[model samples]
Target: MYRILIVDDEPMIRKGLQKLVEQSELPIESLRTAENGVVALQRIGEERPDFLFTDIRMPKMDGLELCARVAEMDADIQVVVISGFGDFEYAQKCVSYGVKEYLLKPVNIKGFQNVLEKLIRTKTKVSSETFVAVTKLEQWASRMEHAVWMLQEAELKGLISEILEELQAYKLKLNRVIDILQEIHTLLHQRLNVRDVYLMQGELELTGAADEQEAWCRFTAAVHGHLEELRAKRKGKLKDPVEEAKQYIETHLAEEVSLEEVADFIGLNPSYFSQLFKQSTQETFVQYRTRRRMEKAKKLLEQPQWRITDISGEVGYADHPHFTKTFKKYEGCLPSEYRQQMGIRT
Candidate 1:
């Protein structure tokens, strides 16, 4: 999906280009029009579109100047020049500003569509190769949400640090990093709102930053500060967080539950929850959860009516072979072999 803005002084040209774009059957999330470079720059600053289509001749600021300004701020935006003049100097200026495609007015439908096709293909490839997928961001944000709720400052920092090390290693792009941070911020806000626990919502903006390092510094500072507030608000408030952790773990055994989420549910720091749970159960949290899952898997395997694959999923192991290996580790044989030894016939 893409957001494209058209900049042309002539209303007819803008409409024609917009129509052609609509007819391209491309994935266009938004199509906006600005009469000249100044308004286009204003819109670009507000939200960086994936592509900008502008005519060379315009009032106030020309397309050449707009391209230069965009390059100065965010060079990732692809600029396609639509000009009435074809002077060699204009071509040179556009090339200098990293303008990949330049179209002469009385725009040929085929040529224009070709440019659109090429840009979309290039963008799709760049997005796949360069940016982390939104789904991955969502998963990370899920963990961050849990960490924030649990007041696990260490876990929060660890998660953010891992992401920053990978994505911000080079100048990949700020928009992608901004998207991830904004997603995290939105999820945290929504989750906290659901609990009727509201805190100071700090500004999380990275689009205006020069690079992702600035984003990392600002995001970490803000989120860590929010964590301090959470710690203060819920300090020593839970009644027997260890027991709550146990109950949450027991109920979510069929799902891939984590210690962080369990601790988050009961509002205890993960390390503190680990020690408390071990003391209460005489087994580590991981040990207890695994033992319980194995116990349940064994009971399910005894029923010949349930398939081994289904039993594996019932015990939270999605991979049947891994479940078989684990079952061998626990029961000393394959599930089918165990059933046969027990004289259980299907």
Candidate 2:
């Protein structure tokens, strides 16, 4: 259903157009009218009608000016010009503005109907394109879900060669297939698709029994039902290592906490853990720890009992000036100002 706006200085002309449109079988969802170009502009801004019909001659502003304004704002809207004179210059101007249709004094119902039909057809084509794009996106998401489920459920090492062949036959990207396989291999602690593994006696040809198939089905069902839960658990575990690293920082706030030491405690390479921690929380591990320390500093500053130096050391700063700098960077104010704002003086 398309929305339409009619603009004309004459009330009779506007009413006539509205009646003719309302009588038509076209699926016009809404129709609005304005007495002049100024009012039309206001209506257009408010409603953003799909189609516009305006008379060439009007007080304050003419049809051409209104069309130009609408085009400047949103070129997607379709416009039709109506005029009392059969002026070629006016028709040329309308053409320049990309006006869809132009009609003289006595409007021809047939010509108007034809233009309306064309506009509706164009709108329908655009809608179809949007639907196709959405459909493709949904199909891609479903395929990814299926692939993840399959990799997590079965011990895919025995079926690697067959799976590779199937993926190739399905025209799946080689890189994507390899990445999925690598993730499964890492999590399951097995060298997938290795020549030695496949060549081992009875490894390649080990077929699952009916009981095994049933178990596989149950496992697949559980995975599908709890994939979101499993993902959350994995994310939580990823955070635990970072949390443990943070504990050491809390215990020795006055001293520096090296990234290497934190990574070693969490059984991860320093560079990789730094990258992973950033990816998970959208903050560098160092920055996050600094923020945590600053928050603690702020809370400690609220207490009248703690001295600035003591508070600074308690939150992991080796020097009072350094703590003030870090606090200003994170809190947008000096530590002393922050303490004052919190009604604490020491």
Candidate 3:
């Protein structure tokens, strides 16, 4: 399936290309339209298209500049330059930036199909050689986001390795790899309250990487170290009251515990405890309690020996109907359904 992006300042041209492609017999998986190179670049970052057909003159960033950036970003993308008679010279210069073909103004359906067919042949050849689906690329982004959010160290390491392999497969430039790593760093930093905890210059520099192997090694090590530090910080002091409160919650998850009970146990006033819990755990007292209870319920449900009724009571629910309802609300499945999905036979 072909993924194409059309970039032109004129809304009519963009829509025209989109409509033409849709009506054609070409095996187009998706077609995206952009007003200018700026939006085009953003879309490329999310998922690089197989073919990019762009006009020469644009408002924010011109096609020439965009082509230059794309050359550095992904060399595999097939670029076709769109130009009028007056801009032929400028479009000619775009050839050096890896543009495959040039389309003159007043685009004809016949010429469009010819150029598109040629590109499709080339795209198919390349795909036969080494094809990576658009969905797989998008999945990498989603997996990376979740790994970073949960601070799953092993999962993060594996994802970083997979990403490096993909970049290597595409043969991206050193700067492009650096930019990708920086984007991940920005995501991680935004999720945490910590400032500049990512790999900065004078700490662990990727710019000085000797080769692709060194770059991947240095990048992963630096990020892993930073994550370790952040994890340690979140662990806090051993005797911290917040830590004690968390332990208390874990220990008494089978019992109906309240904010007042935990607060008194921790030797703090209920109001102060509520505020501290929210600030530290990023959730209200009731929310944290319910989330923990549901987590425990799910864990117990994994064991085939544990009945749904027993698991519910073990996670603090007294009534079977209420447990089923709560479990369905939290997990989008009833307790039995969840266990069945987990491949647990009663």
**Residue 284's lDDT in candidate 3:** 93
Per-model C-alpha RMSD:
19.0, 15.9, 18.0
Q: Give the per-residue lDDT digits (tens) of candidate 3, residues 53-116.
A: 9999999999999999888754468999999999999899988888879889988898898899
- Candidate with better lDDT, 1 vs 3: 1
The local distance difference test score of each candidate is 0.78, 0.63, 0.75
Ranking by TM-score: 1, 3, 2
Please identify model 2 stretches exceeding 4 Å from their true place. 86-88, 129-346
Residue-by-residue lDDT tens digits, candidate 1, 192-266 = 667776654445555665666676766776566466547745675435566777788778878889888987787
Better candidate number, 2 or 3, judged by TM-score: 3
After superposition, the stretches of candidate 1 with alpha carbons farther than 4 Å from their true spots are: 133-139, 188-214, 235-346
Clashes of each: 0, 1, 0
Tens digits of per-residue lDDT for model 2 on 160-201? 334344434533222223323334333322222232322111
Best-performing candidate as measured by lDDT: 1
